[model samples]
Target: MSSCNSAPKRVGNKVKCNLSFFDTIRKRPIGPSGYQIGYDDLVALKLYSNFYHYEIDKLEHDSHYGGIFNLEFSLDGKLLVAACEGKQVLLFDAANQKQINSVDSAHQNCVNCVRFLNDKHFATCSDDTSIKIWDIRKLKSCLRTLHGHSNWVKNIEWSEKDNVMVTSAFDGSIYAWNLKSHSENNMLYDKVFLMNGLMRMKLTEDGSKMVIATTNGYMIIIHDLNLATLATDLRSFKPSLYRLMQISDQCYPVATIYNYLFSPTRKRNRIEFIDDFPNEAEVISSLQIHPHGWSVVSRNINGEENEEWTSVHDIQSRDPSDYENSFMYIEEDIPDEPEPEEPPNQRPTDLWLGYISLDEYSNHNRDPSQVSQNIWENNFQLPAMGILNSGLIGVNASYNAYFQQHPEQRNKVITNLPRMTHFIKEKNVGKGYIKELCFSSDGRIICSPFNRGVRLLAFNNQCQELSMCVPDNPQQLKTIVEMNDYHKDIVVSCKFSPTHYQLVSGCLGSEIKWYQPVV
Candidate 1:
């Protein structure tokens, strides 16, 4: 089912690319006979995006699909599972692109995430507000259905080290299920992580740190999941830190991860970017943590500019020792509107400084949607994709002290960290949402969803090119190669093979394109 084509029928005299992928070894990008590059993996990947240009018109395509929400490759890379807007979960043999099994209407609503616990076992979560564990061996029925969220369950992360299942959703809550207990009542712990617009959470491969992407346009990071590694850098918002993501006066979100450092309390720690980073625009639509956990790749759209950028950021892990603990709920960032002067005896309604017990404020944000709406409106017409760190959740001393320490930054919103190292990428993705993105196992490339197709963004071939002091110039780093001509509809999900140099992607056109390099 594969053939070696020297060039696609409609080859361009000048292929669109920034860096020469194979120039060192070959005068021409592709040898007349086909990929002759000594590196098999590099040739396979290069050909998937570059040589396919010669066969642009001949690219094989499948029948229409309702819409694909996400795709996942099993750790062994022998199997692929797709979660679809059609309410169907599909399993396929990775090598041949053949349907192995499928569960139609797997969820009452759109299935958002499909994760492989192992080659034979997998998990799925949906807008139906429930997470189901399935035995791929029996696709007909799920092994267990865990329900605890009050809204759409956007994502699920498994911590193999602690045998715990973590789920986060639009409900602004994170819940952990102890699989170790092996009981129907396995839901271990639950807590609201944000006031609203919480959409996705990702665990680094080691599960040491977790990053969250929210609709309010922020990235939240939690460090030392199992507390396996302790970070001693405890100066949260210490003035010595370099600033980056500043957009006028508003803060952007970087991350908010609940640390297990405090044991029973699960003390929360976060970075509030009152503006700092590689770039601006945080209405982040998609996020993926790198396998090694040092960084994360996130996609954001500037609704105001009608543009999107995929950014890579270092995970700035801060130690929780600055103050034992204090968690606070922040619904409003600094608004451009002049602050309303408060009566001598009146508490600021928008600025709830008096630690009115967390529960009393909890009622103020019962409806997630309203909280987000009121937050943005009260702050100002937030016009783009971004995140700023807010307050943590614990005691008042630490909370008030956090504010007092940075009196000058009091008006600036708090979110994720500043000092976003690595990369910030922009693409001419005209219209539609880029809902999902992922990093290959080696972390050398990013499989990012483009408008109607997909983009393959290369990082350092070795992935350790962190020597630059300033962010790389945005003039096309020659890293992102588009495999876009193939898909006719907005591509929603894609994944790289963990076991092979293969790729599988699904689109709103209901077509799934599997790219396997033919030597």
Candidate 2:
């Protein structure tokens, strides 16, 4: 069938047209090792902080009763699954924003997290202390029911590398279920690691490293995802979150109660449960590791004033020094140089008395290398990080900004977690704490829940305000897009589409709003 200008003509096993399209005849076989994500085809999201939501009166509950807790996009970006507090698994066709199917009573208790095993199969964990696997085609019954956790299972991560599904629960336990064999095998399924006060766990897209947000006020990172090593050390693990904080005293989960009086160096800035500290449990209940696995977007909840802040925490990277000097410059285009003349300028061998005049040396020669020696992370014990939005200056601003007029574009910064919250004048969402946030596929944007809306933030896109990884101030986001007035209640969950420019969010009012740009 054909028209002269726009028609398909078949001749000798070939199709021809004025404009033609063809896929590769020899398509490479996609294997267990996944390919990289191409962000070129993605769309733009423009709802910034000043953006207003157009309210529409409506009363429709996607979940039977409670609010939606967490959601996920499938690998193909065609399906989305929502874990609701009502114990329902709501599925939708993402492209059309149509409800495809629903798993009523998906869990015995509140479903906490949903993860995709593939396009048609997915996994979900819940407060019922179990994890279940289901095939989208047949939702009447789950394919498998995994039972292990003693308490509420809140996080579920499937490791493509290990072919195991890992789950974390309120009982401070993490177990892995092997999927390769399709049968429970002792070696593949078991407790890989354990820790107290764990609220959630996340893995990078590669399944290389895992980040855990805990109630103990620590952002725990396990290197190389060496769970076997973690399983071994589980015996020596002490809940001495305090002693560890005193020891790694200079590590992740660093926070500042307030910047005016409390020095950034004070250990009290570290989040953790302390009977002495007020509020309640110092909990970091929600977090997501960047797809690149170099950074984490988390809500650092501090007991002080019960503040919550959205922060970007740079974790350990391939090059240890990449994170060591949060204030140093890192040029993405520059080839890895030999760190340049690090060996203290060869003590000019011609000195006769073997003693050079102190005045003869440059400040660089006289003083220790500011970055190499890293006085901040080493001596003073301060977090070298950046914040996105915060009520407090110290939390919202990067310390480097205090010194450098414009800090170099380093990749990491650690600011006061709770201090970086966006201050809303009205009855805001979570005081200063962010309920939940998700990162875009490229690790460049974050859609976090604000008071009654969602904040779409782009980071380090070379914009002066947020170009520096450790921006002097909290406006480290490349741009801010806010969407409000549409939902009647506070937004609870927000996530970016992996392949498209669309955004989806859920609110405490039991609604799921699909946001796509209108041409």
Point to the candidate with the largest TM-score.
1
Which candidate has the highest lDDT of all?
Answer: 1
Task: List candidate 1 segments past 4 Å from native.
Answer: 2-65, 182-186, 226-279, 316-418, 421-434, 460-477
lDDT of 2 by residue, 57-136 (tens): 23245536466678789887888888887788888787767777887799877777898887788999876667888998
lDDT string, candidate 1, 48-152, tens digits: 445232121221233423677789988888888888766788878876777777788798777888887766778899867689899977777998878767666
Question: Candidate 1's C-alpha lDDT?
Answer: 0.56
TM-score for all models, in order of appearance = 0.66, 0.61
Q: Poorest 10 consecutive residues of model 2 by lDDT?
A: 349-358
